[model samples]
Target: MNRVVVLTDSRYLGQRMPGALIEALRARDMPAVSARADRLVAEVRAEEGTAPEPVWGMRRALPALRPGDLVVPRTRNAFALSLLAQAQLRGVRTVNRWEAVQAVRDKPYAVLLLARAGVPTPRTFLADRPGALAGLPGAVWPLLLKPPYGDNGHGIVRVDSPRELERLPWSEGMVLAQQYVDVAGVDVKLYGAGERVWAVRRPSPLLAPAEEWPEPVPLPVTRELRTLALACRDVFGLDLYGVDVLPSPDGPLVVDVNDFPNYTGIAEAPDVVADLVESRLTEVVHP
Candidate 1:
């Protein structure tokens, strides 16, 4: 029987959606398991006219994964990406596909694709040095500086003025600078699970967390938001993803996108995601 393998950090498994999805899959009688991508010890061999094969683990190697199994990549560390790449090369199917995940995880590339595809997005700037951010066009003042790759609102800062931008500590590497929209402390998060797109209103990450932030309340998925969300997905051909939209005076603009996002605040997430997983497996097995 075909089984599902979720690539992620095992320690955080119980606290995240992948863990929940694993349980949900099992509950539905689908065989599932989680492999710690970060802990993986793999050796990949590449040669002419042959797909790469990865031998995993240090001591007791796990049984070789085959094309009949489905891989769901929930981790993005170098090791995880390498394993996923090898898996794809060997004909093992992955939800969202490793290529799509890699493209979308790269914030700069994803945003560029979105903008080029005519999707509304925040005005963006990229610079290798933080000090250079202060010299961007004056109109882009009050912008956000984000680490090239991160999740859960980590390492993001708002620069409201040139002086503030100038004071940013020097960090080595390319940085993403984005126009900060005033959303009145709220953001619309669009979660896509296959054919269903769910929306919720939650406190914006830019806002300081109050002693008690309001729980995210479900919102009707507007046609525009749905179309925009799917459009963003189409750019990367993502299967399971989330789109962050800011309701600004100009219009709702996509500020971020995440692959296999923790389905926070979405009540029906487990069942819906399980359905999507089963459908993908069906397509592969039948086709």
Candidate 2:
């Protein structure tokens, strides 16, 4: 029998998501294990006439993985990517694949990919220097400054003027400047796995007052949001992910694409994801 291993940080070992997934897999009589990416040790071996081969040394012993073993990466850290890449090298199957994760990790690149594929996304500009902000179309006030690689609303700021942009303790890494969409304190979160999708409307953290934050209300997945979400999955080649859309008079503008986001409001997500993993394993092992 092939093994199912979840690669993630040790902190998530007892978290709800990975724990739920592990339960689901075990319920189906499939073997499952949780491995921490931070505990991995690898080395490259080269000889006089042979190509270098990479070998992984686990801090804690794990069941030996075979070619058909399923490796599910559950974290966004760079270490997860490295581990997944090594798994690919050893012919292990991965959920969502490593290349897709690499592309979605860069916020600016993900937005550009969505726009190029005709997915409705906000107007975004990649600014390498402070002066690049001035070249944006309309160069209007209240622009959003975001780190090219960030998540969960961290390191994001709203700048009302060019002076504010100039004074931002700019760093060498690329920054993304986006036109802020007015959502009236409400935005839609859509989570997708394969063809299944679920949605919820929540108060926008940026616009909602802390004292008056509204509860997330479950929403019927609209055709527009469904179409947009599926397009994002196809464009990004993601088997499971989430999309944040801001409702606008112009239509739903996608503001963010998350890689394996927290399925907060989606009740059936864990089981569905488990099913997908099992299906993939069966296909690879049988084919």
Candidate 3:
């Protein structure tokens, strides 16, 4: 029998997504397991007469996964990437394949991909040193400085002038400096799972007040947003993910692409993802 497994962070143990997926899969009589990404270990080995094999374990205890089993890595951490890559190497099916996940993790690379695909994205540059800021051409005053890899809006800074950029605590690695696109205090988040897309509009966290934060309201899935979301999914080779877009005077600009984001207000997201997972698994077993 084929099995469905979800690898995620321990902190998300009680979150809606993979938990909902587990329940849905079980309801369909499929064996499902939710394992913590941090607790999993991946080992790669090569033998003389055969291809390399990937071995997976939890707390040093090896778990047997069949050829047709499905492994979904919900965490974007290094360990999860390693585990997902090794599993795919061993012929297991995965959502948002490791290569795609790794590519999207780098904010600059993700933006480059979007631009190359003719998708609307913010003007971005990689700043290796503080002096690079002075050379940016056509740069609007209020710029956004973001660490290549961040979550929950952490490691992101807004600077209105060169003086503010100079005062930043210089770090070793390069940071992504992007032109801030004004959205009139609102941002749209589009969640994509398979062929389904869900959208919501909320006050931009960057501009919203701490105590008066407005709740996200469901927005109609317009053609433009749907097209952009689907294009992003195909370009990133993602099975499920979220895209953040900001409205501009000209059009919408994609600001961020996230893998397996928290489906905060999307009630049907888990079910949609579960259906896709089952469909993939069935294809693998039947083909």
Worst 10 residues of 3 by lDDT: 47-56
Q: What alpha-carbon RMSD in Å does predicted model 2 have with respect to the real structure?
A: 3.3
In the order shown, the candidates' Cα RMSDs to the true structure are: 2.7, 3.3, 2.8
Ranking by TM-score: 1, 3, 2
lDDT by residue (1-287, candidate 1, tens digit) is: 77788887764565557888998999999988778876668764555354344556644454567778788888767778778887787778889788888888788888889989999988888888678777777887888888888566667888888888656774637888888888788999999977789999989876754225576889999899999989988999998999999988888899889888877788789889999888877674554
Score each candidate by Cα lDDT. Answer: 0.81, 0.79, 0.78
lDDT of 2 by residue, 1-287 (tens): 78898877876665566778888999999989887777766564443232324435466654556777899888886876887886787788998789888888888888889888988877777777656786555545578888888776667788777767667775647788778877877898999988999898988867644336555688999898899899999988998898888889999988888777667767788999999989988883544
**Which is better, 1 or 3, measured by lDDT?**
1
Clashes of each: 0, 0, 0
Clashing pairs in 2: none
Error of 3 at 104 (Å): 0.9
For residue 16, give model 2's deviation from the true position in Å: 2.8
- Model 1, runs deviating above 4 Å: 46-60, 208-214, 284-287
Whichever of 1 and 2 has more TM-score, that candidate is 1
Query: Among all windows of ten consecutive residues in candidate 2, which has the lowest summed lDDT?
Result: 46-55
